[model samples]
Target: MSAVAESTAAFSAAASRELGEGTNDTPAIAALRSEAVALSSKKAWPDSRKERPWKYHNIATLDLGRYTPGMSASNGAAAGVRSCPVTGEHAAAIVLENSDVIFSEASPDGLDLIAFSALIDGRLQKLVDERLGSAVAAGTSKLTALHYAFLAGGVLVATAPNSEFKEPVRIVRNYSGGGQFAAPHTLIVTGANSRVHVVEECRSDEGDIVVMPAVEVLPGPGSVVRHTVVHRWGTNTKVYTEQRMVSERDSEFVSLQIVAGGGVVKGHLESSLVARGSSSELYGVTLGTGNQHADFFTTQDHVGPDTRSDLLFKSALRGHARSVYYGMTRVGLGARNADANQENRNLLLSDTARADSDPVLEILTSDVIRVSHGATAGPVDEEQLYYLQTRGIPYEAAEALLVRAFAGQVLDRVADEALRDELSAVLDARWDSPE
Candidate 1:
């Protein structure tokens, strides 16, 4: 095996010892993996594509049964995202721990929560099942297929129409691996005229393993939904994350992603405006030091009239780290007067560190209001350093200050002071004294 693969196997072995002993010993996880095996062997699947002239399509399918052991829990975290949670609540809180219903709090009254697996149990899984393989399939790509074939956690939340949030809802899952695989799924659905914010965080404890995440969201007219996610699994893990959302008339959706720690992170975020007057916003930030590598890709699909979208992604790299950001916004032919923008900014802290960004736009509308995208990469501003040191600040502190500033644009949007400060410290800790 290649050195990278060998190291991944070592991590997975340690994770197996601590997170899970084996699938046979974990019934819930075994069942989840069995489902994945079934999904991977299916052959009647059709090619994925955009149905309309303005719809954006950039789907990559992979086979899941081909999963290989990795140095960390990135794979498990990514797979965990594929499973849906089954909390018994009415407003549908995302569940963790394999068919375990942990959230018993009084769900916001008038809201409805549906478990994806329950659909498999009750025979209503069809309408959605039809849309599942198409959203982010595992047909040929191991990254995606493994998520579909081996879901261990997932959630579907449908809130009341025209309601507002008194507090942000939070969902979190922590994994301490023991040779076991886990999937945590989450789904958000907002009623017409509703407004609310949601957050999801995942942390793995002490073991290097595999993880997956599969999320689906739907927002109705005049409704608003905000989302934020943070994934931190030690240095020897693998993770796959998938997110797909549909917005109806007058609805708005916003998402933020942070990957401050992991071995290899592959994430996909895709949003489609199903009706006119809808808007979608996708944002992300990542930090990688050491031998870490992360890939983030997103797409904004405009299917309705006058829809709008905006996306910004930023990353900071040090050590022997590597990262990639690929994003695009497409305006359908019938979706005129659409306003869309994309931006990707990267920071490299070491000469051997690497960062790559691809920001693309596809416009099918002739009378669109506006469309633009750009990417930039440069070393720390020498002028800023000179100004700081000349003012009596030490060189190392000045450089650290500037590096922290480079990451601030992302840090500012975290919305939670504790998380913001925590991420800042993670960035600050990576700088070395330049004597």
Candidate 2:
């Protein structure tokens, strides 16, 4: 058999064993896992030379058989205190370790937060069945299929129609254990005219592990939703994330991604404005140090008339770190008067640091208002550094100041002051310490 075939066979066998050992799975979940395993078996492993999305990373080096699926000791029990860094009033908080819920609490408000394992027999079963994989399907890719096949530690957040929350919902996922495969999923569904914000943080222990996280957001008409994800994995961990948002008529969706640490982190973030007057904003900040590699693929999809989208992603790389960004803006034929913009900027702090950026636009409608994109990858300006030095500033401090300024453009856009400050502090620490 070919290498791809062997890898797929090994993964499928492992998933089958896991499924066989699982006795508490609901029928719906069992069916979902079975379908995912079957689909994954038929799909070949992604090849960088053949796939555009996988072009920047090679997965063939990973040993598919060396890692087993992770199991949680929680077993539907809640324990421990919340460890998320985002501090503020929260409507709900859910903490998961190794793809299992260890702690969860929801306020007396109308916001509904529950673990997926508990939702199987609850009143929300129908909702979960309908919206679980609506935004991102299991058949999307091999990695996604495997993610579903080994899905654990899943959470669902929903808002009632016309409801509004003054505080954000917090989610923290912690992964540990060497040579383990972890898959954590989050599903968000909002009713019409509702507004909410979600903050998610991911952390892992210092060991060799692989994580595949998937997030799906579905917003109702006239609703506003904002989501922020913070990634602080260990230097030995590899993470693959898939997050997407689909908006309704007259709705607004905003998303931000912060990458601070990881060995190899790659993700696909997409926003689909599917109804008239819908708008989306995407922002990303990444600090790559040591031998870290961060790769992001983003899409601004306009499927309705008068839709708007804006995206900005910035990264600062030091040591032998590298970063890659590939973004696409698509305006369909029915998307008349669509407005879209994409920008990517990278600052190289060392001669060995590297960055690759590509922004593309595909507009099928001639009545669009505006569509544009820009990308830049370069080192710090010598003139600026010289001027800062002339002002009696030390060379190291001057470079740090320039890097801070470069990252501040995107950080300044965050609406939450506390969260922004915390992220800024994390960035500063990451930039100062050598790998």
Show pairs that collide, candidate 2: none
Alpha-carbon TM-score of each model against the true structure: 0.74, 0.93
Tens-place lDDT per residue, model 2, 295-391, is 9999999999999999999999999899999999999999999999999999998999999998999989899999999999999999999999999
Off by over 4 Å in 1: 1-36, 42-104, 110-143, 414-435
Per-prediction count of colliding residue pairs? 74, 0
Candidate 2: segments with Cα more than 4 A from true spot: 1-10, 13-24, 73-88
- Candidate 1, residue 15: Cα displacement in angstroms equals 20
The top-ranked prediction according to TM-score is: 2
Task: Output the worst ten-in-a-row residue range by lDDT, candidate 1.
Answer: 51-60
lDDT of 1: 0.64
For candidate 1, lDDT tens digit of each residue in 1-435?
A: 465565354334243333222321233433434445554345332234632211222223322223332223334443444444432111334434432334323456655454454444332243344334444455534444445444544455557787876455656565665444555567676778997777666666645556777777777688988887777676666676778888878998988887767777767789887689888888777777888878777888887888989888887777778778778788888888888888898888789778887777888878888888999876778899999999999987787788778778867866657656765665555444221
